[model samples]
Target: MGIFERYAPFVQDYIYRNRWENLRAIQVASANAIFNTDDNVLLSASTASGKTEAAFFPIITLFAENPPTSVGCLYIGPLKALINDQFMRLTDLCDQAGIPVWHWHGDVAQTHKSRLMKRPSGILQITPESLEALLLHKHAAIPKLFGDLRFVVIDEIHSLLRGDRGGQTLCLIERLGRLAGVNPRRIGLSATIGEPARTGELLSSGTGRRTIIPKIDAKGVKWRLSMEHFYMKEEDSESEAADIDALPVLEEKTDTAPANADPGLGYIFEHTAGKKCLVFSNSREECEAVTSTLRQYCELRNEPDRFLIHHGNLSSSYRETAEEVMKDDAQCMTTVTTSTLELGIDIGRLERAFQIDAPWTVSSFLQRMGRTGRRELPPEMWFVMREDEPDARALLPATIPWKLLQGIAIVQLYMEERWVEPPRLDRLPYSLLYHQTMATLASTGEMAPRNLAEKVLSLSYFHRVSQDDYKVLLKHLLKHEHLQKTEQGGLIIGLNGEKIINSYKFYGVFKENEEYTVRCETQELGTIVSPPPIGEKIAIAGHVWTVLDVDHKRHLVYCEQVKGKIPAYFGLCAGDLHTRIVQRMRGVLQEDRSYPYLMKNAVKRLETARIAARNGGMDVNPLVNLGGNMWCLTPWIGTYPFITLERILRLKCAESLGLRNLDTARPFYMQFNMDADEEGFFEILRAELAKDIEPLELIYPNELPLFHKYDEYLPPELVCKGFAHGVLDVEEVRNTVARWG
Candidate 1:
């Protein structure tokens, strides 16, 4: 009986008022797998590792020894600032066990959701777009608010294991367990899960149960890791210009210099001043240009701005006032965020996090180094990287510093294979099957069409969606009425699918953009994307405003604060990377190892990109040439098989290797002008990949490539068959062109 004596005595007096002398091998293997099995647990430790009190102290000691008649733990969090940081750590461990710790989203408060729909017992916390607006407007109070629900948990279950909001949180936990018949028992938490038995079968998918993942030994963390390198300047050398592999690459630009003197925002404003940091920035326009260059280096050292600025386009009172001044442990402040403060947001003693550049995953560099060591410390991060100074004649792949060799191949693929990125579970999501078949026909309205294809094709994330591609997506959503057909044959929600399910952004399934909001007098500064004239200025959460008034039918903008710098937009920042982190950044420029947290200009820019990848052979040719009928290639592969080998060289081996002017820098290197050579260009890409080709014949003529977010209300032949069969990988570009013949 020693899992802290099976928890409940107010979870062992809240783990002895947080002293926790023992129990934490993930809270004694999550209280011996939720008090010895009814299966489905999965804790997967690390990130201030008491994985939410190891799945809530044995599911709140089985809800204080069998007490549920209603709401007995549901939780779910993928940010409403991690459900307001686990609702103040589950309201100080369920207010000494009288329980009742609710929370709902869109910044809660509808009279605290009519006092949790009038007495819905302990633990609710939400947000899969507020549990798809509580199963679409509290559809008959989900069996009196979760009947006798016995534990759902979820929280950052590796950011809902790959997209369409993790298949709309597994179709809202299988339509809230068949509308509250209640199955519950699933747990799943994470620090940065790669494959805990495939995300514990995506957290017990239809909860039949069988997921236990508790191998917790966890204690060795220690990572105050570093990496540095900046440039935006110093040039002239690769024998100064004149077609040195035809120049043009130079990058690093925060308007190239002087925002309190650049050197990577003055080394992230000198190690984020008196600490309690976070910095981050991988776009909300570099989190408002690194919070307006670290608040102009606190107004050029007159001090006091101590920075702050979160992202996802700000405003929810400027991201809950930078999440209440970083959970104010006497606010030494830092913020400058994006990836919205990475995730499991506790934000208290966070003494360091920085990042600034290289984070396009190893699960976002272990969730921004799990926001900073938290209490038993050792989880810090640093990174920074930056670029620019190249183009003298810049060639060997532009004097490679590709974000400091992609941050040393994302820290040597998690220090030599403790890898992270998993759960893509083969796509063909067909835009989350047209958003769960128009949210199961707007929450089961006029059903029938074989009960709307057995409630949206028996949703186990649409089992790779096929009932003949959902009967050609229900005959093109009833020939574009977005689903109408009724007269009792049924399948309702029409008039353009009730203006796309009566917006509140139709309870999200990701991808948004069309924002505006912004404001200034009476503060709101948080959303921007094409809202520039009535005065024109705009930035966000980090200074510069000006605009004054441009209602455009209440999309709003009205701004005022104003000063200098500008660039900030709310859209487009895509990055994919993973072909095992671009083949471990081409084996960190063909190895010569030496990475004890780099520095000294990232170990002299990774020993000059390993002597320009050994004099441009790029570690033995992925083709190079670059003079006459040009060349380049360098596959190393990722971003959708480098967009399926640039549409198999512009739709089938470019006019038989005369391959004219191709051009690409995506998923790294392409440049063209072929006229065949290297073994007649891999024998014309193995005879046009041996004929019968079809990734929709490398899609072209009248391309409708609207990649996801309900692919522009689908039906452009199911958005070109969900971008030619669930976003092109063309068998990882035909197994890297079958090892180039």
Candidate 2:
């Protein structure tokens, strides 16, 4: 039978109601893969291509013919927002077939979850962290809840592949399967993923099934892209050169945008007015700052506030308000957001997306750009790269306009190669190992050490962990009283460990800071780390708030709305860029090829940067001399390798080269004082790199907590080992230096 004919009656009715002239490529391919192959399936297609219905339609059809006694399908999402959105959509589709749909997340109501726990016979959608909680707290009820589970669908599967959270998800699935006594077929979904075959293997790991990735043709479509560079109107820049001149402005002139408004933000304000749009920032701090600045523009321009804020730090109410407002076709607004809104949320008819700075990865750029261009419009992205006007005496490193280069490189790499970053599947995830070990003991009550090792170590995600290293971890945990030994030579959670695993924060594998919830009277604004004292101002929710009182006991900050500007303190955001992107940045500077997406301001900025680089001889050599006994080296590599090289130069070759007072712009360039010249510097680096170097040599003695969340709890020896083996890329460092020859 044809794909549509194979669908159950309700699915057909829904399709007809939507007036789909035919099944999309993803839908047809998903049906064939699910029906013809016994293996797992990976569905990759463009956004708004009905990938959700594509996977659910075939699975729901089978459930109708022969519904399992327990929850038949498990859908795991990366975020609570996604589960909430998909729950409403999937509920409508499965309603007619008599299959109930349930969603479980922190924001979900307890009564809703209690209903599912009692009956437990339909589709249950949940986040990975919630699933982890279910596996632990409901250990006895697992068999009853999912004993007949047939399929496990991981949505936005690419988001989970690179970090400890992804490893935790894999371990949870395997642990759940063992408890429930059923090996469900896995289905992975994504709009932007790299190497489907390799990612497919990850999806099928521990499931005893290979993955079937259907090939689908992606049609060529035009994109609306423009990148502009700007310095704040109040600041002076060195761009007034003989060659650099602005072309005629293309964006609509904002006559009332305030004469002295920041140029980049003004451009965003001009375009986002009277439209449904998303302004994506790389960090929550940036998100808050952008939102607050844009709202001030509304006040200055005598216009209504047309912007909303969405991010992880925002309270559920605040974030949900943005989500709901964007869904209404009548509501014309823009959400200044972080990665929280970059994922697959079906905000209707988004007009355009504006990025304040370059995102860290191509995946993020694609995902943010993909949020728009739905509803028969092309995907549109406007990059507004802002930088402080460099001082005349500012070093060459500061004058090169790294953000502009990075942004151009991100676009060119994807446009030419059609490539995304491959998954870093190999990792010694000792932090996750520690977490899972504690969770297993707490859930199982008591287990022999050998059995515990077998259980935790056997997880496919822990393939890189060794038995000796596990033993070392156990010894450390015992010494620290995180794990207590029993009379029968078994292990259990110690009193100290109970303090950890007993809390909600323990469920997440990612690192987080202790934060206090901010409240204005009875309404909660969001969360902030290390709140300022009374009478101090903090920025959040697109406005400034002054701290009226601090409730340390309840971890709440009482505040009132106030006006002014201040950066929010949200801890640190780590960036790990790919090496190829850096290489492309170098290519952009050396080659004369122009990007059609570059706005006039960006074109002039690129020309000025190219002139500066050529005069400094940066086009030929990676090293440039700033002055006597001072030099800068552009590594042109990714984050990890850059870090590794920094350590190598400081620790290994510093004394020989008289390198001291080191400084870095990270992943772009490094500067330090050295006794040697350009040739001597290269010779010294080549000699140091040619030697037999151990990963441990690159690690600093004082930096143990730099690796992962649980590393500080581990023994220093094991922390060093994990940091060396997993975090450092010495081989890439060697290759980078070899290219210098």
Candidate 3:
């Protein structure tokens, strides 16, 4: 029988209702993998390629065939918005079949969750944090809720592949299985996974079952792409105010919003009017800035405000409103968002997507692009790169438009090689170890130290963690009162440990700053890490608000709308970039062939940058000498390696090369003042690297770097060990530098 013949009647009706002429390729593959095999499955396909239904149709059929006594499926999503979206979608498909769908998260109503607990059946959708909470608070009820769980579907699994949260999810599944005495089949779903085989391994890490990534014929997409570059002001010989494209980026335009506006914003504004779109920003600050700027443009142009804002800091009401607006086919609006919207939420009929700057990775680039082009349309994205005009006497490195070049390189990487970033599986993850250990103790009350070690260490995520390192952590925790030794020679949650585990934030392994809720007369704008004084204005929700009161006791900021502009203050967000991207960026400058996506202004900008790069001989030399004792080194390595190189220059090679006043532009270049010439600098770098040095040598004497969320709570020795052994990629740096010699 065909795949359609295998699906339950309800799914067939739903597919027929949606007017699907034939089963998608993914549907057939997923049915064969799930219906015919007992192994785990990984569904890696393009966005909106029927991946969700592909996995669900067969699973639902199996559920209908022999109903389990408890919830038959556990659906884990990375975001509340995603769960909510899927909850609605699944409800529509499953209601006719009498399958109850329950979504649990911070935003979910408790009454609905209580109903699920009272009679848990059908599918339960939850986030990892919520799942963590479930495992912690309702440890005994796990069997009652999911004793017969037959499947565990992780949506957007690529988002969790490289982080502590991914490890946490794996641990949660394993712990739940042990508690419930069942090994549910695992299935992963994503549109941007690079290495499916390795990802399959990650998916099936704890489960003894092998993971099946079925072979599907890859289909080519005709992407509608354009990239433009604009300076904050036109000071260069080429004016940015002119026509920016040889061919209009958008085939059709709505009414012009602003004639004399910031060219980049104007370009976005002109194209987005009367159309449904998403404007993605790299940061919440930029999202707010772009929203307010575009709203102000509308007011100046005497048009109705049609722009919306959505980010993690925004209240659920605000974010949900934006989501609803985008989901409605009739409503036309533009929502400026961060990575929060980049995941797989079905925002219907999105005409285009605009990126304010280059995204951090190739995976991100693909995800943002995937937001559109649904319903058989071409994937469409317009990249808008903006920077301040270079000063007349600016350093040669400063003259290059890095964002523009980086954006182009990101596009080329996917265009030429169809390459996406693979998961970095070599991390020590000591911080996660600390988190899972405390969680296990809290959930189980008390256990022998050996049993505790076994439970925690047996997790595949912690294989890289050594017993000595864990011992050091337990000793430190005991010293700090985060743990206590029971009279039975067991480990238990101590007073300090209880305080850490009691908070809602402890359920998550990701880092979070102290946030204060911002309110304006019954409406919640959002949360901010730090609030300005009682009178100073803060920016959020696409508008500025003056702080009326700061209730430190309650962690609330009462505010009133004001007319001004202020940058939103969030804590420092570390950069995550691959070395290959930086290397591709250098190659972008050297290439003579023009990218077809470059707009006229972007073309001119690239020409200017290439001229400047050639004159400095940067196309050939990784080392460039500025006037006087100033020099810059472009290592073309990834983030961790770049950080390692910085430490090596300051801590190891500084004395030999007389390096001082060091600074960096991330994976791009490191500029400093040094007494040694280019040849001498290379000699010193080569000599230091030639020694039998380890990643530990990159650290300064007595310096303890806290790089992870739980690093602060770890022992100093363990923290140093984790940073040196897990975080730094010294071998990659050495390999790249060897070619330079």
The C-alpha RMSD in Å for every predicted model, in order, reads 24.7, 2.6, 1.9
Candidate 1 has its poorest 10 consecutive residues by lDDT at 236-245
Q: lDDT per residue, candidate 3, 297-336, as tens digits?
A: 9988889999999999999999999999899989899999
Residue 163 Cα positional deviation in candidate 1, in Å, after optimal superposition = 6.1
What is the Å distance of residue 251 in model 1 from its true position?
38
Write model 2 residue lDDT over 1-741, tens digit each, in one string.
899999999999999998989988999999998978889999988888889998999999999999989999999999999999999999999999999999998988899999998999889999989998998899999999999999999999999988998889999989999999999999999988888888999999998899988888989867788888898654423222111112333444433355677777777877777789999998889899889988999998788899999999999999999999999979889999999998899999898898887998988898998999898987888888998888889888888989899999998888899888888887788889999999888888899999999999999999888899999999989988999998888898988888899999889988888899999999999999999999999999999999999999889999999888889879878799899999999999998867878876788889988989999978768999988888989989999889899999988988988899999888899989988788878888899899989998777868674568777788888888888878789999999889775
lDDT of 1 by residue, 1-741 (tens): 577776778778877777867866877777777788798888877777778887887777777777787888888888888888789888888788788898998887799889988888889888888888788878789899898898888877787776778878878888888888988888878878887898898778777778988787665655767766777453321111111112242122222223426676676676566667888878888788778867876776666787888877777777888888888889888888878789878878887787877888888888888888777666667777677778778667777777777777877888778898888877777877887778767876787777778877887877777677678778877888888886768778778878888888988888888898877777776778779888878778888888978888879888888678878778876888788888888888887866766666667778877887788787668888867778888888888889888998888878889888788888888888788888899877877777767788788989999877888776677678668877787777777777753
Worst lDDT 10-window in candidate 2: 236-245
Please give the distance, in angstroms, between residue 336's alpha carbon in candidate 2 and its true position after superposition: 0.2
For model 2, the local distance difference test gives 0.88
